[model samples]
Target: MIIMKAKIILILGIILSTALSSCVSIMTRTETDVHTISERDTIFSYEQKNAPGNQDMGIVYPSSRTFKSERRLYQRDSIVERKYPDFIRLGVFESVGLIGTVSGESSYGTGMFGIFPDFINLKSDYSGDSGKLFSGGIYRIGVGEWRLRWFRDAANWTIGTSMIEFLIPSAKKQNTLSSIFPLYIRKRYYLREEIPYIALVPSLGIGWYPSQYVNLSGSIDIGSLGGLNLRAYAGFAAGLNSQEAYQVRMSNESDKSHTSVFPYFGLGISFLDFVNIVPETYKEWKDHEHSSWNIGLIQASLIAAGADSSAVAQNSETKLFTGFIFKIANASVALPILNNQLYLGTSLANFVVLGFGEWGIGILPFRVGYWQTIIADELSTEPFIEYNYYPSNFLHIGNRVNLRISDFLNLGLVMGFASGETSMGIGSDITSQYGAPISFSRAYFGISVGVSDRIFFPDELRYNR
Candidate 1:
């Protein structure tokens, strides 16, 4: 009986030991689980605290840490607030081919031709000059603006400053050698989101220098897909100054009154407007993976004009013009069109040199074209000069093919037609008694080299996983 009681005591001891060990194990596991839950909660709370401000600021974060099920939720919560750009800066240079009419005139008649004529010579009834209308090319620049917009997709309204200078053929005989400064307001509207190549821009301003005038103008931009565009410009101006502004002379000395009115139209290449539909940073779409942007640091071209039978015979020789485009700040876009990848960009530069004698300094702001890669970063060719116009009326329409030597260097062969009226001896004169100054076109072949690089954006950066 005593041995049986001892056995019972041993069984009771075993049961108690087992129950105590289980309680210790359960306590340890509970502490560990609480610690893990606390860490997770801390991380989540921190993210929540920063997420609101980041969304408001349009700060995009990587989604690698997010689970698939939470993606939709995260995206909805992180929607960025849309805001308009703070300021929009504009720089454009234009060459105006104009015709003018003088109201109530004398021996020179009531017409004017060629940019800004020698009003004094015309009034004095100079001999060997029977032209009634003065027609010529004028230079203009638009710089600086205060811009307003409600959102990224909204239209832009701007108030800006502009300057216009009339090119007097005979500076010695002309009094209108000064520039007119104007304060203007403009409106620009985008026609479509998918196609940013078309737009309508209109402006109005009052200017004073050689004369006081109120001006109204508008332009339609077309086919700017690759940095080069065709611009149709029209404008009218009414002079506000007195008759003495133009020094008009009549049959009698007492009839010293003049009315100046100018209405003009021009068709030329312009690089004033460029909008990118496919930003380089947008890589979310599989098709956009190859899209890129670049800037050309230096560019050179060889141009030939007057290749046609009529132009060559009239000019007496085929003319060749060589130029270098330097200090370029441009915008480039890559697109897939016609089963090929095409790259286009604006060729805006600060200076240009044409041939040895003729060069333009200060804000040479227009050129656009496209090239196709023939051998993936090794060779590329552009078959046409969509539209390339530099300062003082150097227009180039041609084809170019390039061979890449390194990441930042390229050599190219160019051939095409060019047109310009220059007295610098680069080409023969094609001027006429009745037409505007220095108008000529010819065919050419040229070689070029440039330094360029692809532009990178913030979204291209990667986060460590």
Candidate 2:
């Protein structure tokens, strides 16, 4: 029990630290006003050339200077035109690549996925009830999207799906929140000339939670909001619900959902910049070549933990147990928000104490993070830090260096502090018969091996690019 408490505290700390530190925004937009200025200058020059009575007006046209300026402008325009094909290639291909994505949205007034029943006809229509409107009700849906762009980045079609799980009050009141499989397709159009870049998105999809419900939604994405894309969406949903869906999941609840046209509105923040990438050239697109894929494969570690042992019923000083740890998979992903050099990943590993006849596995995905590349090439090195939580009530912090052997594999040497209850069963001669709670801390070393990049799509085989 003591070790379990420690594990909870450690997990909470990790959550708080990540949430606080990850808010720093690093995106800076580049200026594209050069083309606008060039257009205005060209128009002004044409007007001057066509001015009335210019022949008699003795307008001393500096022919040599004018010719040079015109030549330079023409060359600049030609260069820009030459890059248009590259820009088209980039927009059509970049989003098609599998890349890290994170987004969130909330709908108010309308419930996209039955967030709140529009009219609860339980005791009668409660649609106008102010209490229901401000009940702190929420339905959160998150999805990872696979998007395809076409026609010179002018349009994109996205297909995405996400599992539905309730949180907070929703979970406590509902006995079962199951079969929530949401699939959606959204279309986006970039408005390039807008001062504050904007995207018009119209989406349609279905939420299949035992039954099918149609969802129609639309949002306007404002590209510049403190380096984050701000999305405002409002939509309505048409679906059927059982009587159980109407009952408010609350301590003292009286509600029923009997409405099909549930209206919703919410705001979201995304790492996706649908508008800005529309103007990117092929060379600029190469920077994102490595962004989509992640390091894949499992990492196994031969570990030892300190614990009391005895050949008979007598106790002995602490010593290391020849245990083994095996994680199913390990992968490094580019952090989508920062879109910088930093990367984050996770490992799912299990541990077995051979001497104690005890075993433990990670309860959640163990974080394997910190991949700021200090060096790149055939011989690559990056800093690595890992935080792991075990079902046996063990919490570990592993700090190490990662060396990339090739494009598909990496190796690391790790040494970190481990603290928690010993997973020693009572049957073991060393452990107490009652399975007394055992606690210990030790510094341990482990080696990590895994695949480097798990490609999602070919770099070149994207839409006719």
Candidate 3:
């Protein structure tokens, strides 16, 4: 009974707390962040240009350096009129023993590309009664706040910010305040059963993105009047935690979900600008040597939290957090090992977007880093009695995308959730439970900058050159 009260209060707290927290313009934008596929599992880095597992150069002609390529070609082939097939390629049958993907979109290797600005939904629509909107009447999520959004050509300044804002419905039903007191007692309070309410958020943060592969930023937010929110980001950034699609034991799963925000630091490289390996004597319309097959890289990023835990448990019967936290609950309330320490993850944006782009819709895909858990804590106590946390491991999957609107800025969106159950049954010891997996997805928005000097490998570069 004690445990039930604690958990119930905790869940309700999340519902309430988010009301204020979600009010700050937030950024689901992690164009500069990384994630763990499992619980700190499959650690890796971001490979923006080349897909997963590819070699690194500086910049390929076909991929970028438009003006530079054009200049180079003009200077080299003095007899411009003699050139027939300007930007053309020959086949494997004509080359010397084809070994690697030495060709188009790497039929041999993985074609990779990362979302320009960490794809997210930057637009939203909400219409309904303000009272109802305030109490889960009608509303929408997925709007971010950006400060100093320096685009691909926002001068040579190093500053920017991105914020996300949403609704935190207050309780609407009045049954919550119903109470019957003893005849001897005579007292009545506000009869307060806070309704789920909506919030207007405007986050402000500063960003330092000297290069496309890096962005260091921080911000502070306020809501519910007293600046109820605070946030910051630096180095490699990613969500605080991956989301899970809520799946009822005997019902369908919820595809749209709210993902936790996690700030992190990064230290890695972007193969976006690969060094060109142009042939000695190239044939424009007939030479295939100048082709861009892949842009790959090996990178690493770090994530950490300082005293990132939950508010004191409503009554303390249940634990709140292990490492990081939200207003209501903590993710993995058992990470006693890491305190303000760093977690690692690899970014396969390059491979994901690029790989999917070839198929058409530019669908990006990524594996879980720490999304999988050996065991997720299970609830044992019931509203009737008992108290315990059962733990187990589970699996998760997710993806992200980049939607470019103009040259100066762009938007981004990402979604992911967990699958399978790593439950901790109420029975004696921790047990393994098997069932259909539960998954969650998040859609946010962001603005990308500095794409002027960039080019569309091979095709675009070839013609310009």
- The local distance difference test score of each candidate is 0.43, 0.40, 0.19
What tens-digit string does per-residue lDDT give for candidate 1 at 1-465? 434654694475345334423332321212111112111121231122234333433677554344222222221223333222222333344444443422233212212212223323433334223444434334554434455444573556766664454432221123222245566677766575444346677878666665566668787756444333465667776653344544322212324433345565555443332233323213222222223334444455544322223221234444443443343434455544543334455554433333333333323334445655576646667654434332245565566677777645567776766555433222111122112233545455667665442332213212100
lDDT of 2 by residue, 1-465 (tens): 545654794575445334323322211223233343343234323323344553444775543222223333422432222222121110100101000111121111222222223322222222222323222122333233444565564456655554442211111232222235467677767765342467787988776664346767787866532122456666655654444563333313425533234455554433212233333323343343333224343444555544344211224354443444555334444444443334565543344332333333442344544444445442333454444443356665665556666545566665666556645222222233223335545555656564322322223212113
What's the lDDT for candidate 2?
0.40
Worst 10 residues of 2 by lDDT: 90-99
Which scores greater on lDDT, model 1 or model 3? 1
Residue 375, candidate 1: Cα error in Å is 9.5
Deviating ranges (above 4 Å) for candidate 1: 1-91, 99-134, 142-146, 149-155, 162-181, 189-200, 208-212, 239-260, 272-298, 301-336, 342-465
Off by over 4 Å in 2: 1-154, 159-169, 172-183, 189-202, 216-238, 241-287, 291-302, 307-397, 401-412, 419-440, 451-465
Of the candidates shown, which would achieve the greatest lDDT relative to the real structure? 1
TM-scores of all predicted structures: 0.40, 0.38, 0.16
Q: After superposition, how far is residue 52 of candidate 1 from its true place, in Å?
A: 59
- CA shift of 45, model 1, Å: 27
Give the Cα error of residue 369 in candidate 3, in Å.
Answer: 16
Candidate 3: which stretches are off by over 4 Å?
1-275, 278-396, 405-410, 418-465
Report RMSD for candidate 2: 20.0
The RMSD of every model to the true structure, in order and in angstroms, is 28.8, 20.0, 31.2
Which scores higher on TM-score, 1 or 2? 1
